[model samples]
Target chain A: MVRWEPGTPERLQRAALELFATRGFEETTAAEIAQSVGLTERTFFRHFADKREALFHGQELFVRAFVAGVEAASPTASPIEVVAAALASAAEFFPDERRSHSRVRQSVIGRNPALQEREVHKMASLAAALADAFRARGVADPAATLAAESGVTVFAVAFVQWLREGEERSLGEIATEVLGELRALTSAV
Target chain B: MVRWEPGTPERLQRAALELFATRGFEETTAAEIAQSVGLTERTFFRHFADKREALFHGQELFVRAFVAGVEAASPTASPIEVVAAALASAAEFFPDERRSHSRVRQSVIGRNPALQEREVHKMASLAAALADAFRARGVADPAATLAAESGVTVFAVAFVQWLREGEERSLGEIATEVLGELRALTSAV
Candidate 1:
C-alpha cells in the first residue's frame, strides 16, 4: 500500500485553501501554508510540486472514479445517462460535510483567472477521458465527443446550481434536475 | 479613431512569442521580452497585465468580429449558419503574413497548461456571448445554448485545423469543413 501524507492531503488542501482565500493566492507563500499546518515548507513541497498543486491533488482520484462510473453504468443507458451516472458516482467523494469547503474552493477558483482556467482544463481533460472510455465501449465517433463534452457542461451547470442553492439540496439531486432539464431542453424539438 | 498602444503591444507580442518558442515559456523572462523590443519593464507592464496577456490581446478583437459576423448574417439563417459566419469573419483578422508567429503562438499555448485554460475560459465567454446574442435574436431556450455552445466547439475544432494547416488555406475552408463534420456527426441516428 502507498504511504499517504500525514494529517491527510485533504486537510492540507483545506489549510492551503483557507490561506489562499484569506490572504489571496499570490500573497500566501508555501512557507506560510506549511507553518499554518505545523509542518515544514519541505514537507509541503514533498506533497505538492508547487503552491498551485495543493489545489489539485485529488484530481486523479476524481477522474478515475468518474471514468469507472461511466464504464460500469448500465449497458443500455443513453449517452447522457452514462455520463450523468459517472458524475453522480463522483459526487460521493464530495461529502455533504465538505460542502462548505467545496463551495469555498469553487469560489477561490472562480475569483482567480489562472485557477479558473486550470479548473476548465481539468474538466476538459476529464471529458476527453470519458469520451475515450465511451469510444472504447463501442460508442461511435463524434457522438462520444459530443456526449462527453455535453455531459461535462451539464455537470458544470448542476454544480453551479448546487452552489447557488446554498445547502438546500445535494449535488446529486441538483445533478438529477440539471440532467432532466438538459434532456427536456434537447428533446423539445 | 480609438487610441492605440503605439505598436508596443504587437512588437512585445512578437518578441515574446519568438522567445517563448525558442527558450520555452518558463525559461523566458519578462525582462528579456522587454529588452527584445527596446522597451522598459515599466512599458511592458503598461501594455500587458503580465507576460501571458501578450498572447491574448487579439482575443477581444476576435470576439467583436465574431459577434458582428453573427449579427450581419441573414436574419432567417439557422443558428449554425450565424455561428459559422461569425467565426469566418473573425478569421479575417488573422494576419496574412504572420504564419510563423501564429504557429509559434499555438505551440506555446498548447504546451502551457495555464495558457490552455485561459484559452478555454476565453472561448467559454465568447460562447456565452453568442448565446446571449441568439437570445436577443428571439430564439427560445435550450436551442440557443446548445447551438451557441456547439458552434463554439465547431469553431474550436476548425481553428485547430487551421493552425495545423499552417495558413496555407483560409480559415473559411477549415470552418466549412468543420461545420460539415459537425452536421454529419450530429445528424447520424
Candidate 2:
C-alpha cells in the first residue's frame, strides 16, 4: 500500500494563502510556501500544478457539492427546483471559518485580470457540468442550460454578498434568499 | 479630416477569416492576411489589434446590441422583460447573411483555448456594463447583477443554437423562444 500524506495539501494551502495575502501573490514563490509548510517544493508541485492551483484547492469540492445536490434532488423536481438544490449544496462548502480566507483570495483574484478570467472560466465549467447533470436527470434543452447557468450566476451574486463586510448570514441562507429573488425576477417576465 | 475608409475593416476581416480558415490560424500571419486583401500590415493593425482580433470583428457590435436594448427598453418593463428585449436586440445582430461567417468564426474560436478565454472575458465585460445600465434605471444591487449575468448566459446558449447545423430559425426567433422556456423553467419553481 502506498503511504498516505494526510493534510499535506491543506497545510500547504493555508501557508500559501497567508503568504499571498501578506506579501502579495506575485511576490510569493512555491518553494517559499513549501518551505514554510515544512515540505519540499516537489511535494507542492505533486499536490498542485502551481501556486495558483493551490489557492483554488477547494475548487473540486465546490463542484462536487453542486453535483451531489443534483443527485440528491427529487426525481420529480422541476429544472429550477433541481438547480435550487445545487445552490444550497454549493453554499454549504463555505462555513464561517473559511470566509476570511475566501475574502482574501477574492481580493487577490480581483487584483489580477488573468485571475479574474480564470474565475469566469471556472464558473463556465461549473455551469457546463451542472447542465450535464440536469441532462442526466432527464431534463431537456434550453431548460437545462438556463437552469444551470442561472444557478451558477445566483451562486456568484450571493457569494459576493457573503464576502461583503457586515453581512452576518450564512452562505446557504444568502443563496436561498437570492434564489427566491431570482425566481421572482423570472416570474415577472 | 481623416480619410473615409468605409469598407476597409470589413474587407480585412473577411480576408483574415478566409486565410485563417484555409491556412490554419497558427500558420496564418498578419502580413499575409493584409496582403490577401490588398492592404498593408500597418493598415490591418490600425483596424484590428492583431489577426486574432480580426476574426472577432463583430464582438463590439454584439455587446452594443445588449446595451442598446437596455437603453431602448420601456421604463416600466420588469428586469426580465428588459433582458428579453436585450436578447431580441442581440439576436438581430445575427442575420441570415452573418450566420455563415459566424459559423466559421465560431469554429475558429473553438479551436483555441486562449481565444475561448477571451470570449468569456468579453462576455463578463458585457455583463458588467449591462449591470451598470440596469442600476442607472433604478434596479438594485443583486437584481441588476443577476439580470445582466442571466441575460448574457441566455445569449450564449441561444447563440449556440443559432450556430447549429440545419437550424433554420432566425436568431431572434430562437432567442425569443428560448427566453419563453427560461420563463417557464423559473415559473415551475
Give me the candidate number with maximum TM-score: 2
- In angstroms and one decimal each, the interface RMSD of every candidate reads 4.6, 1.2
Collision pairs in model 2: none
- Candidate 1 clashing pairs, residues 3+ apart or interchain: none
Per residue, candidate 2 scores C-alpha lDDT tens digits across A1-189 of: 998665999999889889988898889999999999789999999999988888778787889999899989999988888988998889888898889878998998888676788889999889889999999999988888898998999899999999998888999999999988888888884
Candidate 2, B69-181: lDDT as tens digits = 99899999999999999888888877888898889988988887877878888889999999998999899989999889888888888889999999989998888888888
Docking class of 1: incorrect
Estimate, for each residue in A1-189, the C-alpha lDDT of model 1 and write its tens digit: 998765656667878999989988888888888889787888888888888888988898988887888889888876766777887887776667767777888888878876876787788888889889889777885567766776677677766766764457877887777666545443332
| Position A63, candidate 1: lDDT | 84
lDDT top scorer = 2
In model 1, where do residues sit more than 4 Å from their true spots?
A1-7, A18-37, A73-85, A91-98, A138-144, A166-173, A176-189, B1-6, B26-43, B70-85, B91-101, B128-148, B165-170, B173-189
How much is B176 displaced in model 2, in angstroms?
0.7
